[model samples]
Target: MREWMFKSRQKLLTAALLLVSAAFAAAQDGAAGIEEANTKVRSYFEPGTNLMYAIGAVLGLVGAVKVFQKWNGGDSDTGKVAAAWFGSCIFLVVVATVLQSFFGV
Candidate 1:
């Protein structure tokens, strides 16, 4: 019985170590994939990326202004609306950047 218990503990420890190592390896792989994807995306946006970024900045600025107005007590609902618009603008910017980088447009 004692031997069986020892064996069980050893198995559990080994399994735990294996799980930890696998998790670490997976995380590293994911990080590498992300880096590779970013490189690819950046390469795609070579020329038009700047323009898309500019547009995104403009939209973000407008949304920030709207949010500021709400903070100043201009309108409660307006603040929320502005925030949503800001988020949408940011999404658009990301999409544009990705497309420009990947599709070269």
Candidate 2:
């Protein structure tokens, strides 16, 4: 009755203490891992930034060609297509720049 209850409480307290200590140790380990992860992320960031710019440039060229074709053909949707392509290129540039700045990479 009373004895059993006391034993159970003691065991529970001991388990809680062990869990707390393990969590503390894991937190310490995670801090070092976070720094390593940040470095890896930064390494990838530069290459990715360059790749995005390249992709944007290629897209711009393709869009220009398409718009020129549409204009030559006297297509009514030429303006819309040109605007959409220009907007997409701008969006890509802005997003890449924003992400690079945000990550300090």
Candidate 3:
């Protein structure tokens, strides 16, 4: 009975060791996965920035049209509205550019 208990304990220990080893191996794969993700994100970054710029351009044009209409209508809040739209467009472009510059990606 004692020998059987010892054998069982050894088997339990062996299984635990194997599980730990497998976990470590899997952790290495996670690092590789992260690296791959980083590379993919960086590859998209420049084009993403360009897309942001394009979106900003489109928004600016739309904002201009809206502001133009407001100005023609003699709306008192036209300046405020125009400023809000212009600020938003600038923010989008600046954020994208700053992120690229900060990350160096």
Q: Could you say which candidate leads in lDDT? A: 3
Q: What is the lDDT of residue 28 in candidate 3?
A: 100
Predicted structure 1: lDDT: 0.81
lDDT of 3 by residue, 50-76 (tens): 999999999999999999999999999
**Model 2 C-alpha lDDT versus the unseen true structure:** 0.94
Query: Candidate 3 — worst ten consecutive residues by lDDT sum?
Result: 96-105
Task: State the lDDT of candidate 2 residue by residue for 35-94, as single tens digits.
Answer: 999899899998898888888899999999999999999999999999999988888888
**Cα lDDT tens digits for candidate 1, 1-105:** 999999999999999999999999999999999999988866666555677778788888888887887778767598568869788887878887677657654
For each candidate, how many residue pairs have backbone atoms clashing (under 3 Å)? 2, 0, 0
Among residues 3 or more apart in sequence or in different chains, the pairs in candidate 1 whose N, CA or C atoms overlap within 3 Å are: 44-101, 45-101
What root-mean-square deviation over C-alphas does model 1 reach?
A: 11.3
Q: Which candidate ranks first by TM-score, i.e. highest?
A: 3
TM-score winner between candidates 1 and 3: 3
Ten-residue stretch with the least lDDT total in model 1: 41-50
Q: What are the TM-scores, per candidate, against the unseen true structure?
A: 0.45, 0.80, 0.95
